[model samples]
Target: MQNKLYLDQRSNAFIILNLLMLWGWWMLYQLYALPVHYAKPYFALDKIPLYLEWSHLWFTTWLFVLLCICYLCTCLLLPHLQVAQVSVRWTLILSILGAGILNVMIYPVGAVDLFYYLTQIKLFAYYGENPYLTTFWPTYAHDELTPLSSFLSWPLVYGPAWLGLASLPIKFVGFDDLLTMLLAYKLFSLYCLLGCAWLIFKLLGGGAPGWYGAYVFAANPLVLFEAVANAHNDILLTLILLVALLGLRHRHILALPAFALAALVKVFILPLALGFAVALWRTRWPFRRIVGGSLCSLLIVFLLVAPFWGDGSIIERMQAAVEQQQTLRTAAPISLANEYAQTSGASAQQLEQLRIVFTASYGCLVLLALFFVRPLEHAMASIMLLLFLLVSSLFPWYLIPVFALLALHPRRLELGYMVVASLTGLLYYPLGVVAWQTEGLTLFQIQLVGATLLALPIVVFLVALLFQRRVELDQ
Candidate 1:
């Protein structure tokens, strides 16, 4: 009876904390209205007074910490709680759904990538232009949504599958209504987020582990912030990846085509698909079955890209998009290295050489890990982590796949690392904001802080691993 009471109290506390976090987000939405233009004046960082800036920072920090606490509590409480109970199951479902809806209402104050997503879909849907081949600049300079898009000159960086799916809401809402379109995208993302959570729950076989996995993906603050609040397309990619994983387990042949479709959402998953193909070959599937699956996968990819192929070479356009993405030097170790190089008067050629080396090294590491890592999900998680660590353009939402994969195979070390990473990944934004605004702070100093944030999770993971090994040896 006492234990049951304790569980109820903890459950109630979890519900209240989530409500508080949602309220905080609502308040934040009101505090910082959507920007007229998504640029340097983002979140009105420059125009806002020092007090308001500090207030936003403090509020955001508190919410982040509170979110971490809630997630940690969920991790603890899930193991003991009886998810078999109807009320318990419904509570989990309703809480996730409620939080997602509230997040849809909140403006994407963290990043304006959603606007870019809208612009690309609008370009394709309304303007009769191929998003993959066309840039949304000089041509659509006066368009209402153009000013809001950060990537005005770059071609669509995402794959055709996402573009096609995202276009539906824009088509329904139409271009005349900007606010509605934004809401539509938010709603679309919320649905995808919910889909991911549901899929995770189903994949884990609907017990304690199922509930735990679902909560880990859905209740996570970072996932909510990026997937719903910011409305990133990573949620869509994650959903498709989960579908692919489900198919891989049930109908082996279905996995290939599903993975192909997933890669169409984001090319990063292509490596995993390749690894899957290799795994299939190693398993010694019949030659005819292998050929049939390969053909089906190819057909899916071809059909998805065919509509947007236009007159330009799709391969060339894809390469250009990849290059454009690489040019972005966000909160990654390479970004820090580039910053230091610039401050120290290092040559551009030298930096390029270093980048080449890093890229090649990462590619090799991924190949080896794919070959060696047992089980498909572990390989996916490991590769995603490698991408986060090695890539130059690191964003918080990129960790979405990591969280999704961890849901399937929740190892202690990776799970703990990712939970910590979600926090540190978010810290980059506020730290960058303060570092940039503070006078006399060097660019190198700013990048150094980002590098430190990037490194902290890895350091913690390593230390924990070492301690675990020591404990096992002592025993």
Candidate 2:
């Protein structure tokens, strides 16, 4: 009886832990706004502070829990249920329609990037200038520039394809009406969501398990909440990357076009795209195939960027972009440097020195890791590089690509990604302001805690894999 009690306790604990993660994701979506559990006599969620200010935060948290439960129920019922007897393609169509309408309802509350996005678009559309350079439009239209623009430019600097897309909603919906504009933006992202879902469903029919990819991809706390709700443009790039991978999977040379589109949308992703290209070359495909692909991609990138570069030589535009990208201190890639400097108490020059070394080292390591694994499992390895970038950051939205892939490919080791990403993302019920402050942690303390939290389990998984050799023979 005692042993039975202990077993039940352990099971319940894990369930609770999963519930916490789901709730956290929901709260992130709600920003704690809708008290999803408000009417319940007995709530399954941890109650947020009753103060109106804390309301949105906790409410969203509860909603995340509810969504997870629904998804969990979906899973539990799968074995006994004949729901999947429906055709794969048809199931996807239903999901897109269901998920799309639900996302639209919560769309307003989902967006945190809206203000910055709107401001930047206005600067570009109305001012006839590169918005990345202008920082922010002057409040007076002829007055002093916004100090805020200097930092916000990082997310604003997408390629012309994105710039054109951003302007579309405002064109039809009137930027003066913030609500309509926001909805239009949501609709644009919605298209990407539906496309990604449809692709995942197609893959599952081909062989991949729906449990690993579909459940997590469509309903994962991270992807649904952050990508759909928050309206992050990263989803657009992620879908393109997924489409590229899917094309590659089918041995369609069309992967190059998809890869090119992704690269043109976001320059930072070119290295990742290039890595995938190299992996593709090792296959039976002729060498000239990718050479043609590369030229075409380069042409597209140049044509779109030509307006910005035509005023000066290619060298000049490249230099300007370098200057422009330096302006933001928040978010991944940059924030890693920002935090490193803040914690080190280093001068600007020292920080710059560290930045160069880290970038070079990171790039070399990434290439080495890519080459090492790329040859082993070309598709899986290339996707792993993207995962490396997604988790190595603090922002909630970076997981868009990982989650989308999870839906389509579904790996078991995602348990590692899930544990880490949950700490900062999907299961991300961020520490309360008081809980965070009261901890009074230094940078070193922060690193220690975070590393232990994320790494310990991953190390365990690695160890268990080694013992699996013995377990296999015993079986």
Candidate 3:
């Protein structure tokens, strides 16, 4: 009885800690408002005050510490609470909802991608301009919300399904009111986040595992910060992917159309769709049925793209956007290689060759996993992790879907790596703030540090796994 009481107290403390950390993050994001305002038009980090830099560093570090504690508590205490019949699941739901609300209120200081999403929706829905064909700048230079976006020159890089789904809330909120529009998008993302959690719970067959998986995705600070606060559409993509997976689990033919819809949100999901096809085949689905499913998927894609297909320039614009993204050297192994090439005076052709090699290797590994990995969820999780490591351009929010996938089949090693990667990946932002202010802190230096941070988790996980194996062998 005493132990039960003690377990209940720990569970309560965990809930309180999670809420407090989220509130702390909300407060920390508020500090970015002035800096964001000053850095408008391009969102460049130039001429920031020394005091603001120090404050950002201190506050970001403290928040991260709290986030680590929250994650650890979830990992260690959740199962115990479940055993004690502490009503922890309901508490988790309330805490997640509270966190979502707080995050929606916070400024999107982490990434200004939310502004770009709004601009695209406005261009398409309000101005009747095809976002795929038109750039945000020069065309809409005088618009009030133009200055808020950082991607001034890029056309629509997102898929049409995303545009179609994202347009609804902005239209309802009235695009003329920017604040309300922002709120609508944030709320939309929050809904998607919750939807992903619900699907995960349902997929896992509702019990301790289901609740744990739900909490893992819903309560993750990285998901809250990126999906709710920054309002990235990745959460929506994840939601669609989960829907597809759920359908597939039930052996429903509609899974194909759902997978197509998910792919239409982001082209990267094509590999997962391919994996889904393999799964269908392995299950001895009839050839004619597979063809019919494929047709349905293609039909859905056509319907989504038909409205945006203007004069065939949308294709060219999409290709251009892909090329533009390829040119960027960001947080990934390729980014580190690019830094090396610059310092070594290596030919650009060499770097291109390296990228091609990585791309090919990713394709091969994905094919192997599709054929060999048992259960579609594990295959999807492996594919997502491969994309994170092997893709030329990586972002922290890309891992949002990874958490959702991992939730479907929670393994300690993969989950721990993701948790660590999320933490280290986000270090890029605060590090950028300080890098801009401190003398001699170049972008190359930052990339190098980022690479090291990303690699640490892999090393630690590998070592721990090896030690565990050795112990088992001895036993």
Candidate 4:
């Protein structure tokens, strides 16, 4: 009886901890987050400033660091605080409630990428302009609401499916009010993320591990901040990718269109589809059926994306992607390499050569993973990790899919996920943009930070690998 009572007490404590964490997150957002244009037009909470002063920005940055530490600590605490089997459903329920509450808060706390999304949706919804062909820069002069157009003035970098899905808010809510549009977009993102969590729970068979995984993702500070507060479309992209992977497991025909749609959202997942397709083809399934299913999937994808196609716009889109990649050397290893060369007084030609080598090498690594990695899940995780490590720019939210993948098998990648997610938040330093613009942080310093953030997990992973190999050898 005492032992049962002890377990009950622990379960109650766990429930309390979950609610406390949710409330803590709410407080942090209310007190520390910088104001963005998304909420500036709507409800103004007097406690929160309309814009961040220098002191507030600095405080917010430090508070963000503290919150990340708290987040990781909570994750570590959860395993020991498991609730009763009956209470398992409460985990997902509270997570949904927390997400909804945060979404309704209407403040763009951690990121400004939502503005870029807003601009993209507005371009298509209001002006009837092709986002792929027309740059937002031309429209910026006339639309005062579309702030930060200068930062993302390039042509459409996202895929057609993402463009279509993300633009739904503007269609229904209309772009006349920033607050309404922001709310609609965030609510949609909330729905997508919940869908992802649900699928994860279902895929994991609703066991203890599955429930824990669902809660881990559903309540993760990064997920709540990125998926709810900042409202990144990567959440939607990851959802579709997960659907495709699940379909592949079940041998469902939707796998093809799902994969195609995922590619249309991000385009990075397309290669993984090729890799998994090869695996599927090698299965005992009939060759003709496989071929027919593949053709039908492709046909549906083409039909869905056909409306966005224009005469000779593919080349334009490709050029835009290349140019954008070339300009962005923010958080990836290639960026570090280029910064190293520049600091060493290398010429433009030398930097260009370095870019070519790194880019090609990155491509080769991805292709190898696509071809060699077995089991579609492992292949997807490998490719996503490669992208996270190699991409020229980085954001904490970019790791959402990675964390989702890691939820399946948490033993190996858990430490790496925690490290990357927490450290990447350091990129949210106050005045980072100003520092970069004014060269306050020299090229070498920025490179050093980026390198550290990328290298830590990699070093840990390598060390773990070597240790495992040594254990096997000894055995």
Which residue runs does candidate 1 get wrong by more than 4 Å? 32-41, 44-53, 281-286, 371-375, 458-475
How displaced is residue 20 in candidate 3, in Å? 3.3
Question: What would the TM-scores of all predictions be?
Answer: 0.90, 0.70, 0.90, 0.85
| Comparison by TM-score, 1 against 4, better one | 1
The 0-to-1 C-alpha lDDT of every candidate, in the order given, reads: 0.75, 0.53, 0.76, 0.65
lDDT of 1 by residue, 80-126 (tens): 77777676677777778877877787667678888888888888889
In candidate 1, the residue pairs with backbone N, CA or C atoms under 3 Å apart (3 or more residues apart, or in different chains) clash, namely: none
Backbone clashes under 3 angstroms, per model:
0, 12, 0, 0
| TM-score, model 2 to reference | 0.70
Encode model 4's per-residue lDDT on 187-273: one tens digit a residue: 888888888888887777776667667766766666677777778888998898778767776777777778878877877666566
What lDDT does candidate 3 reach at residue 64? 65
Q: Give residue 206's lDDT in candidate 1 (0 to 100).
A: 76
